[model samples]
Target chain A: MVQPEKARSKIRIYMDILQAVQDDGMAKPTRVLQKANLSHERLTRYLGELVQKNLVKENQDEPGVRYYTMTEQGIRFLQELRKAESFVSGFGFEF
Target chain B: MPFPFLYLDTSFYFLSGIVAFLVSFYAFRYTRLIENSALRFLSIGFTVLGVGLLAEAFIDTLSFFIPSTSSYLLLHRLIIREAAATYSFLQVLAYFVILMGYLLSRRGPASAASSNGSMNRPPTIGFLASATSVVLASRLGELGVLIALAREIIIISSALSMAFLVAIIYLDSTGYLKHRNKQAILVLVGFVLILASQAISFSLGIVAARALGFSEILDFIGTAVQFAAFLSLLLFLIWRGKIGSTGKSAQ
Candidate 1:
């Protein structure tokens, strides 16, 4: 069973991926794989979910060969995540 | 007024000494997270040796400033003996700790061919054994025997270790090795440099002990080379980002 905490952590991972892409600007799947240390299997599923949510878009013809970019919604999501992280850490609940 | 050669040497030693202390401090502070007990012990021993060498440098500087005082000379002798003894003991301890780590890192090779492979053995043991032999030879005080035996061992061990280090670095730089594995390579390179420098300086010390006019300059140069090597190793550790955060996450 996927625990609630594990699901939440995945959300954070998604944000981190987006942040890394934003920081590096146009990273290939291979680069992301190395940087994030995520296996291909796990990355494919999570990336697919993000595409479904419209938080990220896929290149039409290239499919899995596409690079990930954060949409406006994804950017907003990351900002909120950061705010929450700051608040929790300020309360001595360090991550 | 004499260009403060002594002051310059002492300052460099002090700076390197502080750097070593900081490296050890970081190691100890993050010890809970480090999975490798041998690396932890080696780090602690390196720190102790750094402190001892730093104290020895300070004593040498004092001897120069108070060169004519009988009491000062006595104090200098005492401190030098103490520091050298501590440094030697810590160095040997570090060698054993690193050897243990190398052994542990090679547990259970997959194939029989790879089981007794050269890579599985402690690469730095040769260098350490050479160093110990040189020190023992120095104690014997026989010039021909010391030079012949020590030079052969030190030169052979250093050349082999240097080649191994270069190969590892090349593999890592080309991305043929994984990130964590690259870290292990860096650690090995750091230790190899330390051992190599010590071997060179010990060899020089043997020659300087015999030479009459060049004794002071030789001693200063030899110590400076060692201090520089140690400092470089510490800096490499920092650059590799090995400080803070433990190996628990690594496993």
Candidate 2:
């Protein structure tokens, strides 16, 4: 059973992964897992959560291969993050 | 016709070296006053490069004063080329390291960990490209190959960095970014000029090699472009000092 705080952390990770994909274009699960530094065990579960939330979509053009793409919601979330970053940086808070 | 001695004058190198040293000194001093760790690291890096250039200048002067001294001439020739190449490589590495420090300082350790995955990717790619170029140029016995490879690295890195700086400046200038960080703009302009100089010098090198069969004048011009880059860095340091003092007063 995942704790509440851990669940929130996972969501944040999902958001970050989504943002990375959006900025860098489509990535495979293996690539995303490496970049996000998530274990394969954890990535499957987290990616499931993201797909359910419609923040990411996964597809496989061929068998035995999977690619992840950010959804509209993911893009919106990244924009919000950028705005927050700008807001904090403007105050010389250094994020 | 022989190229003018002014093209490789020791006095020119000495003047540029002194200016670079002074700028690095000021950068270090200002960083201490402002208590910015990133700037401090940058200052240290610049100081190293400045000292290297100064030594190169002294070696060149020695060679000029006694051209017939085979030992001095050999030492001078060896030092000038190796020092310049090593310093140029280090300068690129220093920029990447300083940029990493800046990002880490701005974003806390936790944020650094989070951002590291993304941020590290580009530099890693660039390093690979640079290393590959070096190896290939060495194996192929072609200075042009090396120059081309380095040019690609410098161009891509500088262009990306310039874009980021421009965006920051645009935001600040338009009053969207509330903080008045003109230092970024100044540094950006310096980077642009440095990039332009490198591009021009590299192009000239290729042209000279093809047309004039490797003239020393071409070599001097290449080095001159690097000296100009150091001057730009010095000017930015001065600008940074003024900005820091003003910010202090405002506080």
The C-alpha TM-scores of every prediction are: 0.45, 0.44
In terms of TM-score, which candidate is strongest? 1
Q: Could you give candidate 1's per-residue lDDT for residues B1-251 as a string of tens digits? A: 22246677677668767866765564444332222233344345546556555765676576666454554543443333333433444454444443433343223112211222122222244335545655776698744555456434433434443444344334323322322333344444544455555555455445533662364465466557656665665555554343212211111
State model 2's lDDT. Answer: 0.51
Q: What is the TM-score of chain B alone in each candidate?
A: 0.55, 0.54
| CAPRI-style grade of the A/B interface in model 2 | incorrect
Separate clash counts for every candidate = 1, 0
Question: Which lDDT tens digits does candidate 2 get at residues A1-95?
Answer: 96342122333466457755765678888788877778899888888888898878888899998888888876665554443333223223232
- Among all windows of 10 consecutive residues in model 2 chain A, the one with the lowest summed lDDT is A84-93
lDDT for A13 in candidate 1 is: 64
What is the clash count of model 2?
0
Best by DockQ: 2
Among all windows of ten consecutive residues in candidate 1 chain B, which has the lowest summed lDDT?
A: B242-251
Q: Where does candidate 2 chain B have its weakest 10-residue lDDT segment? A: B242-251
* Clashing residue pairs for model 1: B33-B246
Question: Where in model 2 is the C-alpha error above 4 Å?
Answer: A1-95, B1-9, B65-80, B106-180, B200-215, B236-251
